[model samples]
Target chain A: MILQYLKLLKDKRIVLASSSPRRKEILEKLGWNLMIIPSEFEENLQWESFSHPGDYVVATARGKANEVTKRLEKCGEKPYLVIASDTCVSLETQVFGKPKDRHDAQRMLSLLSGKTHDVISGVSAMLSYDDGWHEIVFYEKTKVHFGRLAPEEISSYIDTGEPMDKAGGYGIQALGGTLIEGIEGDYYNVMGFPLHKFCSTMAPYFGRLVK
Target chain B: MILQYLKLLKDKRIVLASSSPRRKEILEKLGWNLMIIPSEFEENLQWESFSHPGDYVVATARGKANEVTKRLEKCGEKPYLVIASDTCVSLETQVFGKPKDRHDAQRMLSLLSGKTHDVISGVSAMLSYDDGWHEIVFYEKTKVHFGRLAPEEISSYIDTGEPMDKAGGYGIQALGGTLIEGIEGDYYNVMGFPLHKFCSTMAPYFGRLVK
Candidate 1:
């Protein structure tokens, strides 16, 4: 649907400031040329300080974008755009990131069993201008309903080791998909980026070509 | 969650009676040993003959399973199980399949623009018993909501050559994801196979190991 933007954005120096392969794959599907630059920002933000989980993720994503942008500028490399994103699973007041260990993954999965949780992703786009960098930050939330998981189920899933590197101790694109009952929002949001929201948000920057 | 069934089902001969790579990929994610044997049944069922789209798809899936089962029996190759599936996109009473040409794809995409549609998949699992074959059939539905698409956007999407081979003229797991606002139900269902539903439905055959 965005094929028209191919010519306009093809030559732009777009830097993706995250190490997530899922996010990179999503962007590549749109046929954009991207430069991968993992953010060096320490993700030690106090989740309790933020009033909402969405705010917390957006702040972290902005932190990543700022770090990568400044690092590039210091190197005298000014890119046209820098994109960063953070995803977390939240149940009520609690926020869950990657599991620290097998036990932590088991704990997180147990808590999420037979319950509905929110998959929140915060994205920041740093657009380079002659004067400075213009930042746009936003968050997308998707409701995920997990099936009733038995103790054995959680243990087996942990053994697979897929939960260790994923938020909420699960990756929806792989075997973790079997653990989910359904979802009530953009499916891509669960993967760490909101494709539709990102496209719509950046629609203005590409100019009103498609209308 | 289903790791317990690995040993029990690993040695068993499982034949998948469809050529769709998406369905094959979904099943493979479970770490199951699968034998790809695409069905020879022709998908020429009249859509108007059925009372509901779900019924039509189920009948089609059954036809595929029956054809493959009989064909294998003729060759004296009775596998443990045979699975067949059919997927279609329905906007109210109208059912949409693969687009015939570019104009047809544009027409289908235009009808689906800025609207919600149901992605229905019918599955049939045939198990061989001493007496004969025991069959289980079911259908899953997922609601997909698409964002408003401009004419150029639709044309450009068609140009990508993805719409010609996919039902509803889009693939939600690829560039089509950007065109979708959100979805309600198992995301895999929209991808041509309902992973969660398929796993849950076959839970009984796998036996109550986790309990």
Candidate 2:
């Protein structure tokens, strides 16, 4: 369905700004040859600054993209398309990011057990194409529900150490899949890329920014 | 993660008793060489017979497996394994299967709009090994929420002809994904297989399913 963008992405420089292996894997699945340049921007932004959780994620993503774009600009590189994303888990109104430690992971898991939560991923694609710097920001939210989990089950899952490095203390793409009872949005969004939205939004810039 | 079943399945005949292209695609991704033999058993059984929706799906899946197994046995080619599954969409207490036509599709979509629904996939695996016939049945349910969909959007999606064939009038693996707001459970189950559970259940027969 997105084949129209393939021709445009054939010869452009693309950079991904994130250390997330999940995002990297997804982009690679689309057959994109890009350089991974982790953004140095701190992700400790105050959630209260934004009125909504989505805005917070968008701001974080924009920060990452701008950081990378500025870095590449200083390197004398003509211009590259930089893609950055941030995902968070929200239950009711409480937002959850990467857990600070095992205790935090356990807390997050406990809160999510038997309750439905939202997984929101904000994506920003910035480039120096079209004779100017342009950026597109979009967000996808997926609802995920955790099955009723026993305390021991939660403890043992934490011991597996999979939840420590993932947002909301769970990695939906791996062992976390078992804990999930269902999801309402894009699966890849929980994994950190809304491919459908990404492809749709980048279609216009395919040849110029991606190739 | 499931690499242990390879040796045991090397010389065994596996049959997939389903007509779902998505299931075929997923099984291929799992690296299993399976023979497709779509079941001919009628699915006209009353849903009320089962106390729970999950049981209904399990019974349907078992029926399919039994139909296929009986045929294969009479043909003098007993498959080492016969896998069958049936998926349904349940919102509140109402269960939805494939829409009978466009009108039915629209009704199903309308009912699902702005609401969370449960996707129940009942899986049955039957083995006709040297000892005898052994079977296991289970159900995986995923809760999916749909964003409020516009009438035009629903009409356009239906025109694409994707919903007509999928239970619940939506295919989570395709264009229908765009309509989802979130989900909680196994993504593969909504797409018609509980892959993790399948692997776990098949482990014993295959010596060890996951590596």
Candidate 3:
């Protein structure tokens, strides 16, 4: 869907406001030349302050995008567009991010075993025009069904250390894939980026999103 | 779910009887040491003979696995287990495989645009034992919803040369991600190997299948 705009975006100054390999790899599909400027926004937003997990994630992503855009603008750097993303695991009203340690990962995994949870990803597209930057935020929620995990299984997976940096204590795109029974939505959302949603959301700005 | 058997499968002579990079990448998550041997079995079976696309794909995978197993056995190679897989696109009763040419790919993509199609993958696990070879076959279906595509867009994607070797004229794991709206079921299934289903299905034979 977004590949149609590759030529138009080829020369644009695309700034990816995140250093995540998953987000980078996912966005690379558009063939957009990108410059990574890790967002310096403090990700300490209070979870209880939001009415919904989706809103919190979107706000977080927007913060990242806005910080990157402002930093570039301060340096008089021309960035046609800045993209940011944030992902979290949610069950009902509870939200979880990366685990602090192996025990925490195990606890998160055990709590998720043999149950369905939502993997939510919020994305922000900050486009710079002649006047200023215009922003749009979107969220994708994927229902992930985890298989019953043995405590020993969770312990060993944590030993591998793949869960330490991933939200929900697992990376669906890797070893953690075995722990899942299946998913009911965009798998990329579970990978920390929402590919389809990003493309469709940016589709409307085809002519203007790019320089 | 399957990580428990990684140590057991560590020493087994596991061979993947296919050359699809996507399958190899997806299967690598299990940390299984693998050997790639492209099956020489001709995929010329008449599709019309099968009652369902799933059956045809499974039969095709079986053919590949059997041929590879026979070849390895003749060489006195101890291939403890061999895995082979085949995938196709099914829309209701109509089924589509890799496009024969650019025009064919364009045709397939056009038909799939703005419509939901099923990505069906059939896998065969041929286990070699002292007495005989035991074969197990399985299939997974993923519903892929595609966004509407213009003819120009299809032509451009085809021009990128990403659709030729993939089923349904798209590789969901790559440039084709933009074309998909979302997917329901195991995402790996659309990539040509069903990881979760493979692990869960082989769970019962854990002890024997691994070592």
**Going through the candidates in order, what is the number of backbone clashes in each?**
0, 20, 1
DockQ of 2: 0.21
What TM-score do all the candidates reach, one by one? Answer: 0.96, 0.64, 0.97
Q: Residue-wise lDDT of candidate 2 within A1-211, one digit each (tens)?
A: 2333443564667889998898888776545687899999998898777898899999999999988888877897655578999999888878999999998998999999889888889999986755868899998887786777768767767776789888899887665765665666679898888876776566566635334
Report the lDDT tens digits of candidate 2 across residue range B1-211.
Answer: 2333444475677899998898887666545789999999899977777789999999999999999999988888787789999999988878999999999999999999889999999999997757778999999888886877768668867877889999999987666766765576679898898876776566566763333
TM-score of 3: 0.97
Interface RMSD of every candidate? 1.6, 6.9, 1.3
- Candidate 3 chain B lDDT trough over 10 residues, lowest sum: B202-211
Model 1 steric clash pairs: none
**Sort order, lDDT high to low:** 1, 3, 2
Model 1 stretches astray by more than 4 angstroms: A208-211, B208-211
Model 3 accuracy (lDDT, Cα)? 0.89
- The local distance difference test score of each candidate is 0.91, 0.80, 0.89
Top candidate by DockQ: 3
User: What's the TM-score of chain B for every model shown?
Assistant: 0.96, 0.95, 0.96
- The whole-model C-alpha lDDT of candidate 2 against the native structure comes to 0.80
lDDT of 3 by residue, A1-211 (tens): 5676788889888999998998888888788778999999999998789998899999999999988888888999868789999999997668999999888888899899999999999999998778998898999999998899888889888888899999989998899988887888788889989988888788779745445
The DockQ values of the predictions, listed in order, are 0.78, 0.21, 0.79
Residue A186 in model 2: lDDT: 74
